[model samples]
Target: MTSNDAVLVLVVVTALGFDFTNGFHDTGNAMATSIVTGALPPRVAVAISAVLNLGGAFLSTAVAATIASGLVDSQDVTLTVVIAGLTGSILWNLTTWFFGIPSSSSHALIGGVVGATMAAAGSSAVKWQGLVSKVIVPAALSPFIAGSVAAIGTYLVYRLTRGVSEGPRGHGFRIGQVGSASMVSLAHGANDAQKTMGVITLALIANGTLESGAQAPTWVIVSCAVAIALGTYLGGWRVIRALGKGLMEIESPQGMASESASAAVILCSTNFGYSLSTTHVATGSILGAGVGKKGAVVRWHVARRMVAAWLLTLPAAALVGALAYWTAHGIGGTEGVVVIFVLLVLASVAFFAASRRAAVTPANVNAEWTGSVLPAPESKEATSWTPGST
Candidate 1:
């Protein structure tokens, strides 16, 4: 293969890698409530999400067009820029996953690509207006919109069910939670998987393989869908722990409300071609569920930390992206990209090794949260709760 072909191959691979991280990182977005509320077992929740995510990927390509052309000046994007951007995004995903923080993978990818483009061709290369209107504005407003919807839903659910006995109410809500969570999973697939397809399309455009305005190819769509689905099947147990148990102790009713709110917001945003963060919407819904329920406690400290991470996500990933761009540019040619890719792999391995030290898995995913991501040591007397149990 020619040098440009080689670079394009690497770019496609890197884009798929980013999609994989996006999948696992945000699996908690779709299934955390279902798993925690006992609506679905931990493993089962992720399995269902994986199938829906695959299906959702084919549902739309509008968001992919926005990523490929709207956000950055396609004339200025290069194979190097796409590589650096994916590198930045993947690193940020791993960092947040390790700490069990639910940061925005969408922002990380956008920030990385934008940062690399700016570094290579200056701020003029980015479509600042599009960034603000399509990405930033939605990022700011979606959470509030979703939170309000969830709060109202939660209130209505509780009010309507006030007359039901505890046993029947919990069981009914658990069934509803499964359906609601499934919609969120499908919405997530429609929204998040398109992002990687967009990046791959961007790389293709940058390489002159496709016209600047070309849509993502069938191969791109299928590959992205499969990659994300596989990643979802693996699950991000640490993030699941945080969202399911950290934000609040989610009940079946609250879980259904939160998921319904998230699914609605995500589907609407996807239809409008906005690449909003599923993490932000889901987190907001969960917080709103806490507020709407009587005597429920929202862990303000944890929520604050997640919010702080959200605020930092764009700039932080951008800085890394800028640095990666500079490093690759300094080295020049295919060697530069390969060297950076090697370093990224090494960093990923290190993070994985570190995570194994305090591994979170399905077995302990629902262990009582003792104020941290890692569940406290299980006691013999600790009772395991499942769906429909008192």
Candidate 2:
């Protein structure tokens, strides 16, 4: 392969890598409520989501098209810029997952690319109009829409089921949560997986391998689908713990309502070619469930932290993307890409090591919420016999 071909190959691989992180990082969006409410086992929940996500990838390409041509000028995007953007996105995803924050993977991907594009060329290269209409507007509105729907749904669920006994009501809702969560997993695949396809298509156009405005190639679609599916199967337990337990106490009825509302909003946005953040939608739906139920603990402190993360996600990822682009451009050529790539790998390893120190696993994912993602480890005194107290 020629040097340009080599760079293009590296870009595609890096984009797939980002897709992988997106998969695991956002698994909680679809499965967290179900797992927390015991509608499905943690492993079973993610496995079903993975399969549905793979199926969902084949459902539409509208979101993919939007990402390829809507956000920025394809002509201005280069291999270095694409790789740098992926680097920024991957790092951010890992960071948020480590802290168990359910941040938007969608914004991180877009912000990184936009930031890299601006750094490499200038603000003029970005299609500001498309960015505002397609991305920003949807981001602002989706959570409210989803939250409202979930709140209404939760309220109705209680009202309609008031005559029924608690046992049957809880059992029925748990069953319903399974189907609703599956729909969310499917919707997630249709929406989130497409972002990667668009990025890879963008890279292809930049390298002159494909003409501007061409749709994502068949191979691109299939590869992205597989990558995301694999990542989903791995499961982002840290994020799942936070969303399912940290945000609020989610019962079976609330979980069903939240999942159903999120799936509807996400699928609708996908149909309209809007790149809505599933994280925002899911988070809002969960919060709305709390609101609809009287006397339920909403944990506004946790909610506030999530809101802060949402506001910061775009700019923070952008800064990293711009810095990565500058570093790669400064080094000049394939060498720069390699250096940044190596650095990203090191950073990822560091995050992984740190996470292992207080790892969240399926075994303890459903543990009581204690105001943190990683449940505090069982103290030796609690687990073992100390002579002092019996």
Candidate 3:
């Protein structure tokens, strides 16, 4: 294979790696509420999400088209830039996952690619208008929209069921959670999985293998779908712990409301070709559920920290992407790309090893939250870092 071909291969692998992280990192978005409320077993919820997410990936390519052409000029994107972008996104995903912060993976990927494009081809290479309309504006508004809907839905659910006995009401909501959570999972697949397809398409275009304005190929779509599905099946237990238990104590009713709201907003955005962040929507919906329920405690501190992380995610990933581009460009040629890729792999291995030291497995994922994503020690459940912990 030629040098360019080799680089393309690496880029595809790296992009898929990012997709995998995106899956596990955001698994909580679709299934956390169900798992938390006992609507489904932890493993069972993830399995269902995996299947739905895979099916959802096949449902749309509009978002993929947007990412491939809307965010940046396809002509200016280079093999090195693609690799750098994926590197930035992958690192950021791992960082947030380790801390159990449910940050936006969509933004991370976009920021990385945009930042790398700017570094290699100047700011003019980025399509600012498309970024604003398709990504930025949606990011800013999705949370509020989803949150409002969730709050209203949650209020109505409680109000309508006020006459029912607690046992049946809770059981009914738990059953409802299954369907709602499944919808969110499907929506997540339609939205999040397309991102990897877009990146791969972008890389393909950058390499001149495909013309500009092309949609993702069937192979691209299938590979991305399977990668994300496997990641979802593995489950992001750390994030699941945080969203399911951290933001607020999610009940069956609240869980159902939040999941339903998240599914609606995400599916709408996906249909509109907006690269929305499911994490943002899910987090907002969960908080709104708390707001809607009577006397439910909303942990402002945890929400505050997550918001701060959301604000930082884009710029931070961009900075890393730019730096990676510079490093690769400085070294020059395929060797530069390989060096960065090797370093990235090493970094990933390091993070995985460190995580095992205080792993958050499904076994204790639902252990009572103690201001940490980590299970309390008495439960023999080791904990990872949390936004609340120093």
Candidate 4:
């Protein structure tokens, strides 16, 4: 194969890898509340979300177009830039996942590409206005908008159902939570899956395999959808635990309100072709639910940490993206890309090994939050001294 073709192949593979991480990283956005509220089993919630995410990918190409052409100067993008960007995104995703933080995969991808582009070309290559208006403004505004909607929704839901019997009320809200959560999954697919498609499309444009203004090809759409769907099915249980249990204790009605708010905001943003972070919207909605309830407690400390991470995500990922670009550019050619790819693989393995030491699976995902992402250790005395044995 030609050298360009080989590089293009690598770019496509890396893009899909990013798509996979996007799926699992943000799965909690859709299903965490549902799982925590007993609206659906953990595995089942993710499974349902996976199917909806795949379906959502085909709903439109507007957001994909925005990603491909709106954020940066497509003329300046290169296969090398794309590769470095994906590396930055993947590493950031893994880092956040390991710490069980629900940072934005969307912002990471955008930051990586923008930073790599700046490193390769210059600040002039970026569409600064588009970045601010479409991305920055939306990011700043969306959380509050969603939070307000959720707060109102939560208040209304609780007030309206105040007279209902406790058992039936919980059961009814659980069912509503399932539907609202499903909409969120669909919205997430439409929003997040399109991001990888956009990156792949950008790569193709850079490689001259497609015209600069071209939309994402059908194959690109399908592949992104499937990769993300598969990743969603695997579930990011650590992130699930954090969003579901760490922020606040969510009742069924509040869960429904939060999911509804998230779904509405995401779907609306997708329609406008804005690639906003599902993580931000979902977290805000959850916080709103906590606030709206009469006696509910919002964990400000946990919320503060999340807000700090949100503030750091773009700049941190961009810094990594810039470094990746310099590293690859210094090494030169396909070899440089290969070297960075190898490093990414090694880093991923190391992180995975580290995570296994304090693994968060579905079984312990809903374990009582003990002020950390990892569950409290089972007592040795309890394990060794069973009542029957005693």
Candidate 5:
């Protein structure tokens, strides 16, 4: 391969590599509740998530344009800037994963790019109007929206199941949880997976290989979808652990409600070209579900921590991106690519190894959650995740 082609390949590969991390890193967004409440096995959930995520990639390419060459000035962007931005985001992702914090991968990526672009070019490199409308507003609103819907759904679940037997109710809720969880998985693939597609496609367009405003190539979409799917299969046990059992006690009914609520908001947002945070959705749903239940205690401390992480995610990644931009600018493209590749590999490997200490598998996925505390289910459970509930 020619040197330029080789470097281009590396850029695409790194973009996909970030996609892979995005998948596994955010796998908890879809499966945490289901796994916690015994609605789906971790492995089964990831498998379903993988398939649906690829399927979701086919939904639209509008959001991709927002990330690529739109929100940021493509004329000011370079493959090096993209690479540096991706690396910064990846580092932030790995850092949060190790600590089991479910931060916004979407914002992290955007922050990285914004920082890198500003450092490399100037503030004018970012489209402030687009940024405020597309990303900032969504990031601020999505979690609260998801949480409110989940809270209402959870309350409605209890009210609906009031006449059911405890044992039969739990069983029925388990069944219902299955369906709701599956919908979240599918919805997650549709929304979160597309972000990576947009990033890589953006890189291609920025480099002048693909014309601006072109759709992501089928190969790009398929490869990113598959990479993320594989990452989902690998799972993000730490984040799952944090989401399912750390912040709240996820009963089957609560799990079902939260997943359904998240599914609804995420799907609608994605279709409208809004890249909302899956972490925001899932966490808000879980918290809302918890609040909906009578006597359900939300450790305000835990909630506070998550909120802190959310507040810091963008700025942290931005700082990293700025640093990455400065470092790589001195090295130029070829060497910069090498440096980024090594850092991502090392970070990924270290995080993987560290996660082995408390491995969360399909068999033990629900082990951390409370088993007998939830209310019984009423009738047939539906397998769906709607903007609020299907």
Candidate 6:
């Protein structure tokens, strides 16, 4: 009924919009390995990732608690500020996705909130020390940590099974990869879903619907969980192409170990309330797997592009956040938010429709990766493609 109410509604909607983008953008993290390794079909891979992510959403709230309460001064924030920040994040997400860049949606949201808050209430509104100590350092280093661990695990797997016959060794590792990939899927759900829950919680605080320090509500958790789950099912086909195809070709066991290692690290961090980048973790794991395997090709140029994306993620989202906040301010508050929201809707529909022109479905998912309709079957150690099966 009032301007405040309108802004609150807009903020909630925008936060959820960010959640959807988070789902697809981050989908590559959970399922790329499994899909590439023939551990699961593309569609089945997504379906599994979605369900497990939903289940993981219920497992913990420590990470969500950090985002909702730790980063910014919740007491000084406004629904308008939150809305503008989310707008920045959503726009940045689309920009990155359009180019098929796998950026960190979590950092994008944080940077958005910080930039908007600073723009709205000045620098005094932020707690930079806390932000850097909690988010930045871990985000910068965790990937390397996870990557090295994955490389070690991958190498060990091969060394330990060196004496086994090729047939039995391949079969055993294929089975192992399924479980490891599942662990990664579960870990992804734990981290990414909590991010949306945190945003919604922040919106509630900004709106005064909840106490400044209140915990995330059941409704917030469920709504975010379901939204993220649906997005995961849809998958971000672009990043999927890059991740499943571009990095080392993940075989059954190697993909499994990489995903599993990343999953364990992520879950441990979530429990500790640190929101590290899933993109960084997943990307690093894939790279590590590349290093562990013999003659594994690491495309330095493509990887350099991804590394560039990682570096830019926070600052780019922050710049967008500042701009969104100022734009909303210039347009006179709630009406400006409405304008942005309308644009977001139009942009989203157009993008999705355009994507449909040559939609990447499950059947077509691995096709581009292996240069064939089916990555049918072959000897595990066989490097070159079979003429008929890809």
Best by lDDT: 3
Residues 106-155, candidate 3: write the lDDT tens digits.
Answer: 99999999999999999999999999999999999999999999999999
Q: Which ten residues in a row have the lowest lDDT in candidate 4?
A: 381-390
TM-score computed on alpha carbons, candidate 4: 0.95
Judge candidate 1 against the unseen true structure and give its global Cα lDDT, from 0 to 1. Answer: 0.91
What tens-digit string does per-residue lDDT give for candidate 5 at 151-209? 99999989998899778888888898877877887777777777777888877877788
Residue-level lDDT of model 4, residues 1-390, one tens digit each, is: 999899999899999999999999999999999988888988899999999999999998888998899999999999989988888899999999888888999999999999999999999999999899878899999989999999999999989999999899999999999899999999999999999999999999999999998999999999999999999999998788778877888899999999999999999999999989999999999999998999999887888888888898888888899899999999999999888888988998998898777666776664442222433347321212111110
Better of 1 and 2 by lDDT: 1
Extract clashing residue pairs from model 6. Answer: none
Output the worst ten-in-a-row residue range by lDDT, candidate 5: 381-390
Higher-TM-score candidate of 5 and 6: 6
lDDT of 4: 0.89
Candidate 2 Cα deviation (angstroms), residue 235: 0.6
Q: What C-alpha lDDT, on a 0 to 100 scale, does residue 386 get in candidate 6?
A: 19
Clashes of each: 0, 0, 1, 0, 6, 0
lDDT values of the candidates? 0.91, 0.89, 0.92, 0.89, 0.79, 0.79
Tell me the TM-score of model 5. 0.91
Query: What's the lDDT for residue 293 in model 2?
Result: 85
**Which portions of model 6 show Cα errors greater than 4 Å?**
374-390
For every candidate in turn, the CA RMSD to the true structure comes to 4.3, 4.7, 2.3, 4.9, 6.9, 4.9
Q: Which residue pairs overlap in candidate 4's backbone?
A: none
Q: TM-score: which candidate is best? A: 3
